[model samples]
Target: MTSASMISPGDILTRAEIRPILGGSAYGGICPAIEERNVILYSDHEVAKKFGYHDGWLSENDTLGPIFEYTGAGKSGHQSLTQSGNKAILQHVQSGRTLHVFTRVGKITGTDTKTHRYIGEFAIDEEQPFVPRQGLGEDDLIRTAIVFRLRPTGEFDRSDSDTISPAPSTSAEFVPLTITSDMLEAAAVTRNAFTSSSLRSRSNSASLDAAASGKIAPVQAVNVSEFQRAASAATTVRRRKALLIEAYVNQLEAQGHSVGSFQLQIEGRTTTLRTDFFDATDYTLYEAQGSSDRDAVRAAFSRLLDYRRYVRHDGLQYEPKTVALLPGRPDPDLEALLASYRISLIYQGEDGKFSSAF
Candidate 1:
């Protein structure tokens, strides 16, 4: 249908349909100015179509005065009902406006293992709006919720015409490369190599101790105190190394970066010593490692006689917050599209307080 036929001259049309035609032209595109002049002309077009008015067009001759009058009177009636003894009834109807839309998509029916028999059919409510009424009795206001079921037919058109068109493509643009299994496998191998190296270092020291014990049967008396001190130091070093690696991984993950392999740099090493890393991009590696260290230290320090009293004890607490900033207000086209869905901006707030300018 022609735009003129769909929207008559001097008749109201949504701001969305007229903006594009007037934006760059002489009419300097004042949004608020246009909205005030427009009145929503179409209502129950789908209902009209189902009752044999297939075109879904309303001529000037169509009597819409009664329907508009009913809506106006209903609003006044609701107010009057509230002021009178029927305040309960008014409240009942007021409650209906707050009813939420519940939608279920793709509900599949089936049996777990046995063959399931399909029932004949059942009535399904599509766009059900809650309506409230008063019951017959003093102080007895009844709110009866009714669901209106709409059968599938060629009546209502649910297509939205204002959806944004995708950007045009050029032949020179690079196509996205697909990640293959081989790439992931290679990454896994790299991680495993680091882990193996760390394990070997730890095992070699243990083996050396065992070999020394085997060679010296009834060995020369070495200081038991020295042996214990060395062993404790080695354990501490290993624990610290593990904690640092974990912390690094957690930090990277928290920043939305995937943890690949941990690289350790010794005092004079040119190459980074690789170690196995956990793959968790949703958390911070540094923070995780810090938390782990804090817990471990707290446990270890509690056993120490001299150092335990000096260590400041604090409970673990970690919270991450993210803030996003936009360049400007929402696009005019986008705002208009959202308004068609009956959504309105109620308030805009700053970091703490509400602002009326928005």
Candidate 2:
């Protein structure tokens, strides 16, 4: 705890605790005055007042997970993070300091000292975390504000939420959706682009007349039956990963294996670390990663290692066999890496069957 690890998420230090560690009692939400300080105590009010609200309006939209947004510096027209008071905060991440996040636990109007609750600590998720997005300024002028996404580090060591349920019925087919341009047009038509029923009628008549005269290209009716990936790329990746886990779970259950998730509350931590699924019949804890690429595989490795400690903290009678449910077969190097750690790797194939990689 001597280094940055000392400052975990969900840690609310009293002045005595903080002053000794941070070397000063002058810490506040954002103190540009102390440029050398790595720790910044943030409250939601300050976020709303200083940079976020274009019109002094602070809502839940202010902070999403790992994403704390603010109006970019500048007032004239388009804004940039470098131009805003938030510039200091964004630039501070370059120092590689953990950002301590606090929210009001009592009345929102309560003072920072009394109301602030430590939610978690965050780190810069991307090399460049700030990007200007379209927004309105306090003056209601069309402007750009910087959106920053910060990933949560295990600073808080909070209990993990239970995210597993029973396996989805394998009797039902898992399908991917397909989308077509004509389907988009049909959706647009149903949404009513015209001003009134009269306009709609006229537009329909025009469409029929154009087809009858053969003056316009005929649009074939499109059936959008498959699940069109209507989500963002991040969402799509995560969804596909989730499906891989679900399919694996279904496969395991089809073989009469008892499956449930492991939610162990480590004695010392505020949050719990959970495994994706556990086999009661054999006491196997499965870690399902929605990603299989290098970085994700690396993270999954760390999680498995930490869970070993967590299991110890739980002091359960029997240790569970730890297995990772990966999206695909790992590269040889990665497979060897997992084997070196004695972690079992189970992957789904292109044919959708789950297989053991030993």
Candidate 3:
């Protein structure tokens, strides 16, 4: 409502947050130089070249490198984005989520007499908010704030020749050597003899019977069903519920949707997971695309059967019947349009694991 809150410092950025900054568009068209410029600065010159910034603007190149590349102009008419401008853009994107800013300072050596110092800094913001233009109200504003910094490094000699010269040669030189098969065979024989002698000594000193000592007992085989029963009984139901919710969140994130909240309805049980995230706020469940709900359900059930086989448990299994459910409508048989995946529901009892019963 109040444009969320500013992203707090010290938060680790997630893939969702990094995606937009790396290249995702906020309006309609892509930001031309931003992506290429970032690639040049953070990645290799080749990568930047792929994006059309081939001049090595951020690296070894003199005039076109990142150090000399102007992002935003200063008040003095220089074309370089101020530290504040970069921060603002990042913050605007974050929409008050958690963000992390990293700054580093290093020295660059030059081949000539003149030396220069520079700074390197970057920021990663998480869970930024986004509202569609169609959803905007007269007073409702879309704000993006970027949290970033400028890291100034120490100065080093900056000679034009330094850029052209190759890296300094190491003091020690490695020499190539060749060995014959006979030498290898002799070494292998000596190693085998030592190993044989060690084995012989151990065998001579060891007793065969348990009472005499040095006797190793064979491990007993465990009953698979019994182990599964014990494992299921020991697991906490609450933890399973948490896992289910986490799986949903991860799935949505993978689909490029920022999940804000989710409601899990299990009969009379209702659980909700909420966040002030951007993008999708509601969703409808559907069966996998191009598959019937019954078939989709069967596939999910098959996976459950495979899981049972893995745990060595035997039981009569039933496939879950899946359907599409909108906000308020009868479940539909249209499964061909929805994405589907298996999600564990819970460890219902000692003998079985419960999963999405849909």
Give the best candidate by lDDT: 2
Off by over 4 Å in 2: 1-229, 312-316
- For all candidates in order, the CA lDDT equals 0.22, 0.45, 0.23
lDDT value, candidate 1, whole model? 0.22
Residue lDDT tens for model 3, 174-208: 11111111111121111122122321332211211
Candidate 1 vs 3: which has more lDDT:
3
Candidate of highest TM-score: 2
Error of 3 at 191 (Å): 70
Clashes of each: 13, 14, 34
lDDT of 1 by residue, 93-142 (tens): 22221111111112234622211111111111111111121111112322
Model 1 regions more than 4 Å off = 1-229, 232-237, 240-259, 262-278, 287-358
Note each model's CA RMSD in angstroms.
33.5, 19.2, 27.3
TM-score of 3: 0.16
Q: How accurate is candidate 2 locally (lDDT)?
A: 0.45
